[model samples]
Target: MFSPRACEGDTNPVLIPFLLAAAAAAAAPPAAMRLDYFHTGDAREERFALDAVVREGPWPGPPDRRLDDTGLGRYQFEVRDAKSGEPLYSRGFASIYGEWETTPEARDRARGFQESVRFPEPEALVTVTIKKRDARGVFQPAWSVTVDPAGPAVDRRPPPAIKVWAVMKNGEPADKVDLLLLGDGYTVAEMDKWHRDAKRLADTLFAVSPFREHRARFNVWAADTPSEESGVSRPSDGVYRRTALGTTYDAFGSERY
Candidate 1:
């Protein structure tokens, strides 16, 4: 979730034994906090509602880099101390709902989608806000919710019991910039193939320019779950299979997308 972008590292069935952490601070990085919520609306209007708060793995980001100054993505989220209203952490991210609302279909129908934002856990109650871009591409607050990191409502359960293993482990996840390769659409019978694929991708990444030169700064990890069927749902060809990560080839009605 830290800078590699959410499409890969964030939402995947893990192999099981992974603990990706971050660069050192005076103290250990805070535990990662995930806020799950609903994104619902039509093209004309949108809304957000809290779904859940989760205590995930240890924080795997640069401790000093608490604020995102890059100005990237169509949406942004900010975590602020509830009392003083001082910003604690912030990040810019793009979401499926952000893309869906642009499609012609959204204009005719109202729909709801699930979305989540992750940040370093805070000590006291904090207000998390989601913002969206306006006509001039300026971010405006879309929703805000207050959360207590240690509250009973936070889900502290461990991740799902999928098998997790290191593709290349230089050190513990907390010590290095970790990259995760998630295998989607592979069945239990094809786990071996998934492992191979993950290895190939990780190796290729490290073999390239910037990654190769600074390879020691990174660790590659991987995981996936068994799907009932093989392959993904490719609607363009009428080929459909139920997979753990239900990623389809013909997204947004475009085969190339």
Candidate 2:
């Protein structure tokens, strides 16, 4: 649902986790929030140049009894290869507000509100649509988002995607090869961030025993996907442990969380 350049701004504060006591004074109009794509754990501070987008909007301002009514909201996001103009992941949803309050002076307030949330990564876009519901139960489009105008970095030599196969000795499958997948438990964008980690793991494996001796006869697997589902709960499913990090999920390469 993202077009292009719906709104724009500097690297201002887009999202402050919902605990600001001064939120009333911090509300504002929609602004383009910039974010970077990083490969997980390259270095605590070393981030790869990938494209990500963030937008802020649907904020309540000083009362306009005859005109405007909305509240402050923010989103912290990350996406990988998004700036490459490639389709990877995509979603679209709206944010709604309910539980509201009013001060002695008759100012409207909100307590435990709801908002429609949509994330579309496969579309090479991350979209947030916020709408407000009025007393008569009507929905109105509040704000929209799109980002990363700079595009993705150009690489003459893009690394190969991870692939796994049985090691072959004279074209015959061999055994005992170990595949290790590593990653960060933080965000979906981290999947791209872990690519380097995966390569590093492969190199390390090649430097070690049994693996080193049978370098051509051994293979390593790298599950290059983010662990975003690790913290989520799903019923009627088998419990899964994240081997790369200390998180758990009912996840696999082909299974939906």
Candidate 3:
């Protein structure tokens, strides 16, 4: 359960259900696993190679909702039992690589993007499959790899040390939507401002229609590593600065991103 100080004095009776859910989640939840890979391709050819399998922190999603039924995104990945071929988990997601592949630059040359997919740590050996949507919008296998949770090849290094705090806490993470706010270019001196901005953004998000009505069903978290400088680089303006997260302006020729 989150500390009482996390949410301050904005208590409402509506928060009780979410709080109860949080308590249950804390009792027993699976560890999170991440598959990091290089997605290399162009307009005509594509390839995927495994980089590392890492144990992330605790699984924050509901244990019951292991399979994603939503048919969204340009790509999907599935984890299946090695012997039975039974799917244990799946998710649909979009990636920067998926979008970049459609650009004219992809036709001119090959490129690669670092990507990661996260899921609950499985109990046994599993085969992971990556699928992409065809021209007719059907998903076809792009890559597949086998994973052993206890394999010597799996990387178990601890995640980077950074401060994290809850902006809003409703209940156990498994029972609620968890939103992570990642600050891109804030400097060490501006971390306080970043925290305030995260809270303000959460407030703004919950002030909208659907979110406002069901605000109790969500948790907001914020984490950031300070950049040496205070702003992102804008190559169009001939200005550059090293940032902690390496985000830059004019990605894909879009100045505002």
Candidate that scores best on TM-score? 3
Write down the lDDT of every candidate, Cα atoms only.
Answer: 0.87, 0.37, 0.90
Query: Order of candidates by TM-score, top first?
Result: 3, 1, 2
Number of the candidate with higher lDDT, 1 or 3: 3
* Clash count per candidate: 7, 22, 3
Pairs that collide in candidate 1 are 15-163, 15-164, 15-223, 16-163, 16-164, 21-173, 21-174
Alpha-carbon deviation at 215 in model 1, angstroms: 4.4
Q: What TM-score would every model get versus the actual structure?
A: 0.81, 0.23, 0.86
Judge candidate 3 against the unseen true structure and give its global Cα lDDT, from 0 to 1: 0.90
Candidate whose lDDT is highest: 3
Off by over 4 Å in 2: 1-186, 229-257
Error of 3 at 176 (Å): 0.9
Estimate, for each residue in 1-257, the C-alpha lDDT of model 3 and write its tens digit. Answer: 65667557766455778888899977778889999999998989899999999998888888788899999989999999998999999999998988888888988999999999999999889999999999899999999999999999888898889998889998988889889998878998999999999999999989999999999989999997799998888988998988998888888777657
Model 1 regions lying over 4 Å from their true place: 1-26, 169-176, 206-217
Give one digit per residue, the lDDT tens place, for model 2 in 39-79: 21111111123333433222122222212233332222222
